[model samples]
Target: MKNIYKGLILSLLVLGVGLAGCSNDDNNPSPDGKDYASLDDKLDYSLARNEVDFLMETYEKDADRKYHDAELPTKFTEEQNVFMQNALTINLNHSAPVVVLPMLRGIDGNGEKVYYIITEASDFKMAKKLGVNYSPKLKYARGSEGVQKATVNGDGYMVFEGSVDFSPVRRIEPGTGEFAFPPSVAQPGAVGDENYSPIVVLPSNLVLNATPVKNVTGLHDRIPEGERSLDLDEMWVTLQILDGFQGGRAYYYHLVTDAYDQVPATIELGIYAPKLGKIPQFGQSTLDEESALLGFSPVGNGIDDLQSDNRQGLSSAILSDQNGSGSLAPLDPINVFPIEPQNELEKNNNYSPLWDAHISKWTDEAIEKGYQRRITSFQDLKSLVDKGWVVSFTPDAGPVNSYVAGLNASNAIINCPVIAHPKN
Candidate 1:
């Protein structure tokens, strides 16, 4: 009887192990599943209505086609399907880290330009926003620079940028205890990432250029009063963004100087909504407003921790998150392009400090966010081609410089990417 009992217990343990394995099998699916399946269906076009309207206006005179679901009426026709397939092939040439040309492009039958477009920015969603230009446009000042955060997308704030140390300061502040700079904010970088070190600096327009002096305050009227060379010197002007009511706006960053004139090879600019003043420059955001289609989170979580090893349940996490709806978790994809040489502006201005390492993407929580990563093992040149909604092109070929130009034109500090994203 004792021997029989022992054998029965061993059998039960084996059954338990088998059940656990089956459960994991049921849970796991490949990453990029939805994105791949959507591509296969060829009907998941999501170009925005306004963009569609623009396209329609551009090609309405032609009698060759109809329109349905914001697509050319004959979008499913054989010729149209061929064109779409070709466009997808071009887009999916998956050689890019951030999915180059994240949209569909084609020519209308009338020989007019027809773009199956996606909106990098749109005003349709309430409280949606983007930067226009640098403001308070100061050249000189004292202490703390630039403004950020605080719902500055609507009509009550002004977008401002200021210069600081040109060298990238990775450890922004020592001993993490809330931030010292108020009215201004910057996104926190990982403890260690081959990060963009930006010294916060004052903008060229803020104050008159002054030599490094001692004990000076930004936006103060007394700097001109002193004649001594050693009194409160000005070095880096704190950059700031003004937010709040038009008449009562306050400067979030106190716009001052870093104790010297010499800055660094790189710099970080601050953007924010200051307390209101005479003129309202930027807008306000609220829970009442809809969510941004884009998202921003540590790429390591999605791109590194998850994609690199397919560790634990990472791929399954991506699939489940992108099942359909959206969440605002930090795991969103921010677009990033590897800084390449031979670019004119990067060479001349050398202003990489102004760029963020990650561009924001369509946001959702960890549970709802699925990774849309594409990896390929290339043994040859042609292997660099892109696949699906992911396309990559090498600048060496023709330097489709237009791609860079489009990025500049959008002035997109970062674009939030969408998973199973709708076009617009």
Candidate 2:
């Protein structure tokens, strides 16, 4: 009887080892047959440098493609240019390139300058000509204390009645927290008045998601306009200039750091919201159909956690300590890339400013099986999902678990634009 029991135990151990080996083999292969444990391993960091050089060269060679004007140059086929123009108008109601200019709002108590980006314009003609989003819905956001009225000054800059106070130290410490619950500490950096929201009404009565960027009181001087690289600071923040080609025409985007509910992740780069439905847009179809057509899908629980009342799902950065310490320390820039579509062919020239919001949380099973670990890359997140150690879904369907929701019907979305594919 003792021998029989020992034999059964040994067989079980061998089976477990075999399964483990198969899981590792299945999850780690790159396109070139190279084994990489993390998605960052497959990324060619030099591509970003090359992209910056290309942008500089394009800027110097073609005055029409200059960065400030927000116009699509004539280099592209008329049809392609028209398509992009229509997309901006129909979807975002803006005609500008995916890249936008950030406006400095005010200085925080920390002496950091609060910045915001404009996405939509009120007048259709102005929106088309200026390449900004046009939304009648913006009128609804007006007249509220939280919703500031914006106007275009004689200098061609936007002026706002109220500004956001980004002085708060935004921090999220996971501290061995479960995925579904809130972290040990979570604080938004920026706070507006009682009714302040990122989405504001423009002088033209058109609405726009005036999402806050970062506080750049003195950080821009560290890397002059001519010299910026993918170098990480003590806070693990860096600047990444991403270039993407749509219909064979090259486009550039400036990525500084990602902001969560509030507060800029880093001080150097401009800011963009990594999650969607934080602000209201004109149509639901744009967030649904248009996003998919542009090659974006919801990541984990895609839009399921849109209800702030039920589940609070944080991105990998907000929930992990693998990167570093502090709220900004654990944040990694590489999470911006899509997990699927490792190559250009897979991407099919469908890159857009919309990013797949890969929201994630550690599973109860993961903690019990001792499988809980920091997710550092898209590949790492994908592998865990496959192993049932993590739960990932998209917002294609309605909220399944929660009764009350925050975002109006729209799923949790991410507005990040693709700069360049890692494999490209």
Candidate 3:
């Protein structure tokens, strides 16, 4: 009887050892179905505002490097990464009034887990507590369906989740009244289409120097969230390509927004005169020296040619081909009997719908400097050269002047003052 009891005890011991071995398997599951060790220890998600001190310290040490590297999250959605970057950036700014909120766990569009934060941009006292030098004000906007929104003082508001959209950014140049547009997004509407091209109404007194191209259009400005339409005076001088130059169809675009605060209407005409044209001196071009005929040199790469590193001799071979005859011909008007071909300047032929002023009022200084001639037609432009008066042109830099020289021959207008039509 004692031996039978011993055998039974041995069998029980063996069975207990087998159960322990099964419990210690690498694939053993926790209550959440994931391996106990596989779960992230740092993510103690049950606690609201989880581990703020530790998270902030971790972010403060490594956030910049991660942001710069565009390091995305592996366990979370991309939007979470954007939120982190935005929070870190604003919190770090010495002048911005902001504080980062703790991570709140959530799910994204694909049902994947993500983390996000709610920032306090409106609290100046919080900014002071963070050691900010100056408390900058903030504007708020309702965020998009899946993204967060933030505002910059001069750059307008930005929307981001994993990426940023800058379509709402707008800028106004202080003295020149130059406008940087905030482009609009296309929306699906149920009723009549509300979309329209950018339009500007000019003061009724200004006459167009040239026959303005009929098809030249304005930009499409979109209103961003948390902001109203711009009310400041803004203008843009741009060039438009109609068809191909090879097909002999191209024109310049002169855009002007209405004057506010009694700012007098003026035009800054940018031009594109190919150096290959023969009537102008061969292999000579300058925006500096005044032309004998026009008050300003009639040449430019147009707005399309602005470059940072500076383009060189781009059109020399083409312009230099026929000595001078190969240069571009002026846009000549058709079906006007009394109008001569030489007088068919595009500038004089086109005027904007907003142009209402028939007489352009010139400043006293301009009249004294012999630049007060009223340019009624192409004939008037020729008269400037016929009278032997110096015509001014402005080249932004030396490389542009040098490039112009290769086509026209001389770099006469390299350093001329930028031509401006001062207000009356």
Candidate 4:
């Protein structure tokens, strides 16, 4: 009996040792020999509202300044990182970087209260300091009824002449064709009045794009629990809670789609333009200096190429059917621009809101050989382009005898901030 007891104790000790070894190995490698780590493991997600409060306080103090051309930090700071993490947690499924800005309340032509978020400030320093992109070209958007004028009040809040109506039911139906190039009908949920444009000129001659986020009040109660998404036609809205000096305050964060980047090419589909003159430069930093971060070669003399209404920038890239039917269809009117930053290093070094645009078409031999398929990655697209299975072109020079895609001009400017790139 004594011998049996001793033997059992030894067996248990050996089992425990084996289990410990296995647990440690599990952390280092998987069956496929890939080391996996959760986002939580790599990042600290502790909430820090004081950081945001400090930044906002600084911005308010400098609000009355006439010019803000001072150099600002380009890289993310500790405060910015904290705010980004908290904002990203509101919706983990977001495809683009989530930017959270302070909402300015105003009464529209109607007596109801509306909220707007500022993106591009005409002052390059102010724009960078606020963590938003700069657009000196917004100065030209003034004088149009499409552009709304606003004044910063004593409380540092914006007072606008009119507001956007976000209660419209947004819908889009793709055409019955295999590619569904042009949607049978498409409508954005939010619409501004005749006086409303995304561009807002301030009292200090500072022009900025103030995009509408929410119009109706009490819509928060309608959102389901554990679900933060409130789809508004093409745009999405999510509520965020911040613990500031004023205590807990709720703000709305808007998620807008970005122009899909196809390596050396950029493709744009939509925009909110009340008139041709109201179209602001999509990703430019200043009027004279092109963005060092975003590589782009404009189609014509800058924004002038898009002035004509007849230009319909459509690409011949066929959308492949998901069910393996191998049917081809025309793409929607997409404004393609030639871009640089061909590799990950260039992308990381000078990452800008501006994306390079390219038009890709499958070659006749590729389609005949069944080598044409949907591209899954930047590498795959480049590989096909190299093998002559696919041919790429500038917006000005498309495939021979093809239908005229739209003009090589940007039609849309999505307010999406890039957070991180995937390591594949």
TM-score of each: 0.20, 0.42, 0.17, 0.47
lDDT of 2: 0.33
lDDT of 3: 0.19
Best by lDDT: 4
Writing each residue's lDDT as its tens digit, candidate 4 over 1-424 gives 9657534533432222221222222332321232324211210101111112222443445333211222533233432322222121333222222333344454554656655555454443345445454543344444544356665433334566665544444344434653333334444434445665556655334555565556662222112231244433222344322110000111112223222221111122122334322333333422243221122221111111223322222322112211212121112232222221111221112223333333445566876786643343344445665687766433343212111122122333333323322121
Candidate 1 — what's its lDDT?
Answer: 0.19
Model 3 C-alpha RMSD vs. true structure (Å) is: 29.1
Error of 2 at 367 (Å): 9.7
Q: After superposition, how far is residue 203 of candidate 1 from its true place, in Å?
A: 30
Model 2: per-residue Cα lDDT over 139-207, one tens digit each: 333443334444433222334444444455445554363332234555544444433344444322334
Clashes of each: 105, 22, 42, 13
**lDDT value, candidate 4, whole model:** 0.35
Off by over 4 Å in 4: 1-101, 137-146, 217-277, 280-407, 410-424
Worst 10 residues of 3 by lDDT: 200-209
In angstroms, give how far residue 82 of model 2 lies from its true place.
Answer: 16
How well is each residue in 80-147 modelled by candidate 1, as lDDT tens digits?
11111111111211122111111122222122221222211111110011111111111111122221
